[model samples]
Each structure stands twice: as structure tokens, then as C-alpha cells.
Target: MSELLLTVKELKDIEKYSADGYVLGYEKYTFFGASRFSYDEIASISNKANVFVLLNALIHENNIEDFNSEINKLAKLDVNFIVQDTGALSLILKQISPKRVVFNPYTMICNKNDFSAYQNEGILGIGISSQLFIEETIELSKLDNALILLYGYEPIYQSNRKVLSLYQEAKKVRFPNGQLYLREDTRDVLYSIIENEYGSVIFNCKKVNLIRRIKDIKEAKYLLIDTFLSSEDEIDNVIKELNE
Candidate 1:
């Protein structure tokens, strides 16, 4: 059976459509500067579905104090925590027992060496980047680790500068919804939008998709199918198609 990993928004929709029976996983949009959810919120959501929560280290530029508190609360709920950041990772290892933690893609774990380093740190899984060639994935599978990706948009560039400025100037207007978009050369914009538009680009790098590379992930210890705003329907459809 195929496994799926969804952003918080898609998971919300899935809960509505599946009547709280759909197995759930959560990803923190760290690049977006969104606030961490409270423990009560986490438990409420997790209780609604078989859920695992990813702790975003990129949130507010990786506030260690806040990150620690959030993970502590999640651990109290007995919810699975996927963390990014060396400081956060080290803190979790030292403060929280290893049983409730998972490693997140934000850790930038790219190879077997990276994987080996985390194994003893109680990391149960490692997310492989979509940019990796098939050979790299084959090598990754040889290591004992769970891996995840989805057949959707990959996050690409991240910046400290407000990206929405470019769009406002080009369009000669501001967004009514107050959403931000970075301006780039026309060609660069198109390529970036197509290749890395899902995860927040303001802070985290763009995520790469491997929809065409699903077969490679099958060899992984676990496969996490991801979905963000642009391809929610596509995610559900893929899951249905693959599972059917």
C-alpha cells in the first residue's frame, strides 16, 4: 500500500473528506514564519487521524527556545515529532527521550554519511530530496531509514528579502489577500514557479518533486507522499490511482 505525507492544509481537507479515518502526517511550513500550534491543537488533530507532526525549524529563523517548547508539548501528547535544525535536534536528543522523534527533510540530510550521523541520534526516517538522481536514491535505500517525497511541486529558492516585492512592481499593484510574491526575471520566474512553488520560498529552499520518479521510492523503507496548495487534487488523485 502507498503511504502519504501531506501539509497541514491538505490534511485538514482529508479529514473532512475521509471522516477522520484517513491516516495523517503533518509538515510545518517553516519558511513561512507561521506560528507553531499549541499542544492541545496538536492532540486534537492527531486524535482525529493517525497523525505525525513535523516541527519546522525555519519558522521565525529557527527560534531555539520556541522550538524546544513546541517539541516538548508534542512529546507530552505522545505525538510523533519530526524535527529540523542541529540545535533543535541536539536539544531533543538531550531533553526528550529518543522514542518520540523523527528526522525532517529540513535537516538537509543528503547522503549515507548524513544518514549514518543521525541513526544514533534516534532518527527513524530521513527525507530524500527530489533533486537526487536515481543512482543516489538506490544508494540511499541500502541504508536502514524511512524516506519520503510526493508527486508534486518541489521547494526551490529561499530568501531573506521579501519576494513579493518583485511581483508587486511587475503587476503594478499589491495583493488584496496580502500574500507576498518575489519578483524575478520572466524566465527565472517561470522556471522557479514550475519547479519549486509549493513550500514557502521566503525562508526555506524550494522543494523538488519526483512524480515521475515514484518507482525509485518504492525501494525505500517508507514512502511519504507529499501535497501542498497547488496540487491538492493531484495528490488525492495520485493516492487513489496508486492505491487502487
Candidate 2:
């Protein structure tokens, strides 16, 4: 069976659901710096299963110099790093020599040419962006490179402007700790968040379910399922539905 990857925002989820006999991989949430959890707390989740640290370019863009150190710390715990920054990728390849790193598709890699560029940089895999269609996935699979098919919701809008605006507005409301409750309208939508970063973009596109599809994905050497804050049952359901 092909492996299932899940993105988590909490460490407790890892402890409770990932303790034993769970078919899931993990990617840390790195979009906002307000996770309130230290890297040590996040990396501890890796003990449950194969864990990958997702470092968003949005977060790393501000303090580019820290990328190497961040990667180094995570590497010490034997955690794989997944990145979106070209510069950071170069750094990891040069300094850390991480066991594996998947380039986040948020950078919008559309064709084989993009894959070729990263492949030259020694990147192990490329995440097919949410903007890509099935035809693009097939084309990407044809390329002589590793591929990560985005099997979950697509991260639609990422902007320092919008999130900042929301945070500012939340501060005004004094919303108990200035925590911005960013909500997306997903009503009547098979995919949610049509415009927000975590909004739904890909729909009815055959969620990487069939074993044949999984086999096609695994053929590329690495595979992952990208989902946000998914529960244990949800994770198990996706695996069962896909594997069946």
C-alpha cells in the first residue's frame, strides 16, 4: 500500500492517534509563526512515525539566515525537511545534507522544466501545486523526477498583506489572545476555501484513491498526502478509501 501523509497543527494529535499502527505521515504547519509551539515540541511528533518539517517560504523569507539553523536543529532529531524556498533548498543541499526534502508545490511548479531545475539542485522530490490539473499530474509523473501529488485541499491565497490584515482586525476585537480565527466559506463547495490559503481549489479530481493511482504515484520514488488538521478517523478513512 502507498503511504499517506497528513499535515498537523497540534502535537497532541500525534501522541494520541499516531502512537501505534497508524498509516500516516506528518508535515508540520509553518505558515504562521504563532503555532505557540517550539521546534522541539513539533519535532517530537516525529517519534510516532515518519515526519517531515514543512518550512514555508512566507515564514522563512523574513529571516533567511535562520533557515540553515532551523534545518540543522530538525535534522538533529532525524526529521526530514520539506521546503518551498529556492535559497533554502540550496542551503540544505550544501550544508545539512538532509536525508530527504520535498519541495512544496506552493511555489507553483507547472511543468517538467521546473522539475528539471530543482532536480539539478539535487532536490529529492517536487510537490505538484494545487493549481495543477490531472493532465499536469500525468505529465509530471512522466518526468524523470520524484513527485508528490497534492491529494487534499489546495492552499489558495498566501499573502503577507491579507493575513496581516486579519491579524490586525483580530487585535481590534480583542479576541482572547489575539488569535485570528480565519474561517473560510465552504458551503456547497466540495473543496473549501476557494480564495484563502487553505481554501479548496481542486475538486472531483479523483482524490489520489485508487491503488493504480497510488502505484503510479509511488513509482516516482516518493509519495505523500497533504491534509490539514485531520483527525485519526479521517486519516484512517482516507487510507481505507484509497487503499480499497
Candidate 3:
């Protein structure tokens, strides 16, 4: 059976819900995290909550020093890091045990060969890309040390450039909103978009519904529920289904 893990975008979620573990995001080191937590604020987190860091942003060359300093400090605390950049993964492994790190390159880690290559490095887990079709996911779930996305708006695109601000500058008026949506010419559904100082990320417009399918995915080591931009009502509904 897989362990149920949830993203803790707010402190309230920690008190209101239950799960095997929690993944928290801070504005400094994570992209697509709904909450803001400075380095000092989140470092003081209690060990009892089983909270960890979502350090999945692409670390740029200029910020490597700050990034390295942050991870090394975080390593001293009781936290596991879910990292995205391959460079970031190497740095994190040096500071903490490979068992405490999960390399989640989002769209990478699709096949068994790629999966095994990472596992051989002694990392705790690797994210099974949300872009993979259900059949592909079904096959990959049979493997060990897999972190599968069970629900929430999945991030399909990420960029280190300021997409929103650049567009706003071009338009001659401040867009005044970081949150926007995009739709293909032929598509009806909108893709959720959010931009921050670090970069911009585009997410699936709709939640990936797999709450009821947990039983079928018995081999996934961890099932993640990311609540990036979801509502409390939506979370409650999904929690109800998980309980059922």
C-alpha cells in the first residue's frame, strides 16, 4: 500500500486534515506553492508534524550560493527535500542523505530505465511525471520507490523567466494580476497560470482525479495530493472520497 502524502499550503490544513506526511512549500525555494514562508519562519517547524520542504524550483547560476546555503541549513533540520533540478539534487544529496531526497523533475522520470538509474543513486524516490498517460502510470506504479500524483492541478509547464511581467511591459499597462489562464485555439478548458519573482508555471486546468483509484495502485510508494490552487471545499470532497 502507498503512503498518503499531502501538500500543506496553509498551516490550517495541518490542523484540519490527516495524512501520513505533509509537504510544505516556501516562497524562496519552491514554485507553485500557494503559501509564503521565509527561510527562518519555516525552519522553526516542529519535527512532530512530519513536514518537509518542496525545493523543486530550477536553481539558476546566480542564485547557487544562496540556494546552497539554504539547503545546507535545511539539512540540519528534520526535513526531506523534493528537488527538481538535477544540479540541485546533487547538492542536496551532499548535505543530506540520499534517502531524504526525492528528485521530481516533473515531466522527466517516465520509464523504468530512467527510474532505475536514479534509484541506483540511493535516492528515496523519484516523481512519476504527471504528463504520462494513465496506462504509462499504471505500468510505472508497479516499480518501487515511486511518488505518484493522485490529485490536484498538475504543473505541466515551468520557466525560469518572468513571463507575466515581460508581457505586461509589452502591453504598456501593469497586468496587476499574477494569476492568468491560457487556452489553445481549439481547446475549451483553460490552463491555470501563476507567476512569481522566480518564474512562471502553468498547471492543468482541472484536478487530476485519482482518489478512488488508490486501491488499484498498490505498489506506488507514495501518493501525493498537491493543493496548490485548490479550494477548501474541493479538498474536503477529495478527503471524503479518500476516506470512503
Candidate 4:
């Protein structure tokens, strides 16, 4: 059986959902996603519940040092670090001891070969893309320590530029992180968009719901649920519904 992991974006959420399942804190995001907690807050959480940290970011050499400093603090905690970029992975693999990390390159892993490649590189695990079909997911699950995205809105597009910043300037409006969204003008579809100092990311219009297929993907070691866009009540409901 696989374990349930909840991705928390707020401090209050940490308290709300930590009891039901393992909590994953988003430490940084250079493309999309919402808020990140302070090292102190993360340290506090680690003292209580089973926790992990997502250091998924598209980083460059210039900002890599700052990124390293932040991760170095989190690395001290007894938590897994899910790395996304090659540079970040290299930094963690080379600098961090014991190599407690998961390689999740968004939608890059298409087959078992990809998993083997990552494993060979000393990654502890890999995050399976939600875009894959259920059958494909089951096939990928055969690999040891496979991590799959079982819920949340899938990211469709991400860019290094401050897209929301430009949009806000032109529209004369303020669209803070986790508050703004993008949609097709022709129809009503909610593609959530978030902007930070790093860049902007626009998620898919429909959030991925795979609770019904849990049994099928149970072979996977971990299933991740990103709740950055979900309200407290919504997250509570999802946890109840899934646990029941």
C-alpha cells in the first residue's frame, strides 16, 4: 500500500492536514505554485508530523547560491527533498550526505527506462506525471519508490518571465500569488496562475482527480496531493472523502 502525502502551501494548512497524512512543504518555486513557508515554520512541523520538503525550482547559476543556502537549512531536518532541476539535483547529490532526494522532472519520466536512469544517478525516487494514463501509471509503479501526483491542478505552462507582473501593470490591477488565474476568453475555464520573484506558472483548467484509481496506483510508494489552490474546507473534505 502507498502512503498519502499532502502538499501544504500555508502555515494554517500545516496544522489542518498534518494529522490526516504526511505533509510536504513547498520550499521554493521558480516557475509556478503559491507560497513557501519559512525554515522556522518547516522546522516546527518536522518536530511533529511526518514531513518532506519540495525544492522543485528552475534555477540558474546566478541564483543557485541563494537556493543552496535555503536548501542547506532544510537539509538539516529529517525530511526528503524532491528535486526538479538537474543543477539542483547535482548540488544536492554532491553536497548533501546520504543523498535523501527524489527526482521529479515534472512530465519528463515517460517509461521505466527513465526511472532506471534517475536511479542510476543516485535519486531515491521519481515523481510520475499525472498526464500519463492509468495503465501507464500502473506500469511505472512497478519501479521501486515511484512517486505519483494523485491530485491537484496539473501545470500546463511555466515561464521564467514575470507574466503576471506584466499583466497587472497593463490592467492596472494587483494579482497576488495564489489569487490570480488565467482562462480562455472564448469559454469559462479556470487555469490557475501564480507569480513570484522567480517567474510565473499557469496550471491546467481542470484539476486532476484520481482518488477512484487509488487501488490501481497503490503499488506506487507515494502519492502527492498539491493543495496550493484548494481552500482549507476543500482540503478537509478531500481528506475525509479519500480516507473514508
- Candidate no. 3 TM-score: 0.94
Best candidate, TM-score: 3
TM-score for every candidate vs. truth?
Answer: 0.72, 0.68, 0.94, 0.88
Per-residue accuracy of model 1 over 1-244 as CA lDDT, tens digit each: 3345545554356554332122233334344222234456667767556556765435454456766676676666656556555676677678886655566654376788878877766675666655667678667766766565554455555454444556568889965553334445653443222111223353223545555666766666555544443455665676666655
Per-residue alpha-carbon lDDT of model 2 for 85-194, expressed as tens digits?
66777777887773467676564788788778877767666666645665666567666545454355444555444444365487875334322234337644343222
Q: What is the lDDT of residue 225 in candidate 4?
A: 80
Model 4 per-residue lDDT tens digits across residues 55-125: 77788878899888877877888776777788888888888842578788878887998788887876777
lDDT of each: 0.54, 0.53, 0.83, 0.75
Clash pairs for candidate 3 = none
Error of 4 at 158 (Å): 1.1
In candidate 1, stretches whose alpha carbon ends up further than 4 angstroms from where it belongs are: 1-3, 10-29, 32-38, 59-62, 105-107, 165-173, 178-215
Alpha-carbon shift of residue 136 in model 4 (angstroms): 1.0
RMSD of each: 5.3, 5.8, 1.5, 2.6
Better candidate by lDDT, 1 or 3:
3
